[model samples]
Target: MKIDTVKGGAYALTCTEACTVQAIRADAAFITILEADTAGQYSFVAPGEAVEVSDENAMVTQVLKPAALGVTGRSGIQSGGDVVLRNLMAEAAAFSGIVNANGGIHVPLAAGAETDTASVNRAYAMGMAQLVLMHQTRTYWLTSSCTATNGVTINHAAPGCYCEVLLGANGGTSLTLPTTGTVSGGDYSKILGYSIPFRHNGGAAGTWIKVSMLIGAGGEWTESLDAGMDGYRFRPVSGSAPSIARLVEVTLYYHEGYKSRVRELIGVGKPPGYVVRTTESSLNYDSNTNPCSAAYRLVITQSEISYTSELGAVVWLVMGGASGDTVVKLADIRGWDTYHTSVSPTLYLDVQAGEYGGRVHLESPTILNGIGNNTYVRYGLEPYQRSWITAEAEVPYKEPEQPSAS
Candidate 1:
């Protein structure tokens, strides 16, 4: 029987019927027959009784638990330009398709620039259950007719390092420089700057290396490297005009890592049909704010269910994305707020994402329909963008009845 019995303590129960008193929570305590049944009380026993309190209330059975999955080899894949990633698993498997994925991605590819800022290039989520981690970007200032040589002191005086200057030259042009260098007290000598493994101090500071490369008459050079003393700057080798193909821009993407064979998440790879995430428009809803109707919406909406331990309402935004695609897509979801949000007595947040978009779901709590919010949430609508975000709680998650024999 269920009673507030502790390890070494006992309570009085004036039984009306004969029965065995068993600890409903076996792990909690043990019940042994205490006193003699003198005045019409037939002494009872622990677990089962001589003086009955219940007919069939006690049992001795073993319980088995699900196997534990190891969290080893679970790391994220860094992606962007020429870098596509496998699903980067977030905070464990909430269910099938949704994970608490968080990380950054670099889009090395640059978006085409428009002289008219009004014509902002439009971008879309990978679509479907595929999640959009983040959209990142940066502008560029193109230059021409610059000159630089080797042994240039960039960010430091002696031991500090310089930012990597990735260079791309137009035409049959090439750069000859040290592949590696070690700085001693602010100096590394110089060598024929074109060869790899050239030593510093020999390839050191103040030791000018000849700026040489195969350059066509109209060829130019571009680099992320800054200029320093001597010929350490990057420019035309000699007798070459800056080509039209100079430095323009770059972007990167970061993402989470996943093992397809292990965690069979249907939401990671292919488009899982329509998903309903968040809307870009700001609106006050009496019931629910439907997604706004427009073209190039770039986003779609659909639904499914998942789980969460968190009760109440939570706003899910695309924190960032990880992929090797060149173009970066940004999602602005913070322009949202909540009011009069209600939740289950006990619950967890579940997330569902698919082709339609992504949504915030609850982990099947009780009183399911009560898993909704009356507060209005919205975003600043732009000329060339659309959005989707989902609520993270669903209710009426009733515990299944114990199996019964027919």
Candidate 2:
């Protein structure tokens, strides 16, 4: 069954704590407000408060939707190994749709709750691998000249290894140049020695120096560590593979509190005659990226944050297509600007219609650094297979029909 088939009821459960309702459920084709009567005050269920529904096991799933209480989608790279539980959406929807035919939202009881990471690491390690590769590449400049050298034989080192230069007897040092060739010595061959390319590790003092002051030792016959003492920085070494640059940026689009402003500006209904790219051929409506007009599908789900006719908490936008609506789905979200005032959080969505050469605009309020800037925008690359989409909660919507009548 589709999500719309389920019945939903809105009732205020508590009067003291912002008069918010704790849960919502589907009772047959109708929705029932959980704990509405017991709380003694169920009139506070405002336009943007919490929403709860029923689950598959005939149990109640609290805050399963992004609009529910304590529900949050936290994104980050896993630091260590760990095991965690994530509710698979498609399966949950299918399972929940079977009996009730009404979908449910599962609220995470462990927001900010610490959990073990042993098993989670195994799976999340994929993301961490990218960071590790970046670090390693940056350290050696991604060149093949950073390997250790073998002291046994002239050619016994690895493909990218370096050879050392020995200090000769006549105050001269034996430098093993990167190339292999013969050297000729003339009369002043003592000063005009074979060219041996070498390098040093800028020692303990953190002073950056390739070669220490060349010392003149008349001529001594000795084969020891001092023979290669005077340090030199590592020379230019070639690698088997060529080097290349890797610079990647991943941007995530989320609600920046613009949803709250929509309520104050224009609450729901027909979305203020917003224009969507349609084609000249027919009028079915485009949701995915439409080559004909550059129109695309974007997912937008709504829920109530703290609410009342005058004030309320901000709403969140979910990734993916909106329920039963596709106009906003296909629009491209672009442009971003951060504002200073609580009323001016940077939010600007530039919906471009390339195929048709047109554009639409979207903006929202955002909060930053503990202040309510209340605006934000979506930017960069368009939709990828598994990306995210967040809708502003303030954008108004048609209030779902009440269960008692429908």
Count of clashing residue pairs in every prediction: 94, 59
Q: What is the C-alpha local distance difference test score of each model?
A: 0.21, 0.21
Show model 2 residue runs off by greater than 4 Å.
Answer: 1-67, 70-162, 165-406
Worst 10 residues of 1 by lDDT: 258-267
Query: Per-residue alpha-carbon lDDT of model 2 for 207-270, expressed as tens digits?
Result: 1111111111211111112122211121112221111100011111112111111111112123
Give per-residue CA lDDT, model 1, range 290-383, as digits (tens). Answer: 2111001111010111122111122111111232221112222111111111111111011111223221111111111111221111121122
Ten contiguous residues minimizing lDDT sum, candidate 2: 242-251
* Model 2, position 393: C-alpha lDDT score: 33
Q: How close is candidate 1 to the true structure, as a TM-score?
A: 0.16
- Cα lDDT of candidate 2 equals 0.21
lDDT of model number 1? 0.21
Model 2 residue 11 CA deviation (Å) reads: 2.9
